[model samples]
Target: MQLCEKYVMQLLGMSFLQYSKTPMNDRWRDKDVTVFTMHDLVHDLARAILADPVNNKGSVVGNGCLYAFLTDCSKPLQLSATSSANIKALHFLDSGKLELRGDAFSLGTCLRVLDLSECLIRKLPESVGQLKLLRFIRAPRIRDQMIPNCITELSELNYLNLRGSHNLSALPESIGGMKGLMHLDLSGCHGIRELPK
Candidate 1:
């Protein structure tokens, strides 16, 4: 029994080590690879984890492993695929000229936190309302941008930071409908003259 337990632990450790080395291997050997995206990395990680028999033993363990990998990774990337239903947070900092596809919002129905700080993206899709689970949004420097009125429909939103958005003139009148809002930062938004009633 002791030998069996030791073997099982070794197997688990090897599985984790194999996954942890994947991105590094790609970075070192695939210098010429240009088609790889964050979405591809995530998809590859999922496939690698699921292919392990230890993770596939139960849904609870599989999900736990996936979340652990995502949270513990030194650099987390933004969502870019329709298959990213389990992603909870997306951070797109300084990623140049991000042009979000129309169906992107619909794909991120499970997102809890979204940080697009300093990204070149000018506007958010009206389908932002579909992210009912979103709790935090930090989008700074999106000058002259007008957020969709549908944003007020995010009943779970708690923190919204729009600092340095100088040309953002106004908030939607329906802003009051976001009952869960606790913190709203509009610092550096010089165009706003009044708040909506």
Candidate 2:
């Protein structure tokens, strides 16, 4: 392990001894680091890593990683990846309505910022509460979607946006549970007639 660590440090400018020690465990915990590839990542490993709430660095992957996933069209959200770990911030394409359906509660944990604008989504997972560090959530086009009552668990959240969710007629009675909320946007929620106090 020591030799491998020295070699890895020489090749990547960092020590990998911590990773090498955990032979059975695929996850290597650290903070403030940036991941830039998915060549060695496996799907199960990614799931295990994301399921942990103790770490806080983001995984960065290349194009090949993008092709490795299969979509699940049944659930409200599905996330498949060889590398989507320790992400603090995420930017989605095709209108940010992530095609997360095959796997329920795939958003994982420890996220600080989430943006899913104009994605035409209809709902979010109750598992979103897994993101204990989440402070911002922005998904404007998901209409009539039932917010998980668990969302009230995100005591760290400061911002929430439901703008343009024209069909979101109701919100969790727990809306009043977000004690850290500083700004909320429901600008285009035409169907909403009441907010939880």
Highest lDDT: give the candidate number: 1
For model 2, what is the error of residue 38's alpha carbon versus the real structure, in angstroms, after optimal superposition? 31
After best superposition, candidate 2 residue 140: deviation in angstroms? 0.7
Q: Estimate each model's TM-score.
A: 0.58, 0.55
Span of ten consecutive residues with least summed lDDT in model 1:
66-75
After TM-score superposition, the amount by which residue 41's alpha carbon in candidate 2 deviates from its true location, in angstroms, is 31
Q: By TM-score, who's the top model here? A: 1
Off by over 4 Å in 1: 1-83, 99-105
Q: Name the lDDT of candidate 2.
A: 0.55
| Pairs in clash, predicted candidate 2 | 35-60, 77-100, 77-101, 78-100, 78-101
Q: Find the number of clashing residue pairs for candidate 1.
A: 0
Supply the TM-score for candidate 2: 0.55
TM-score of 1: 0.58
After the best TM-score superposition of candidate 2, give how far the Cα of residue 6 lies from its true spot, in angstroms. 44
Q: lDDT per residue, candidate 1, 62-145, as tens digits?
A: 333312112211222334432466566655434545554335445666676666653554666576688888776767766545
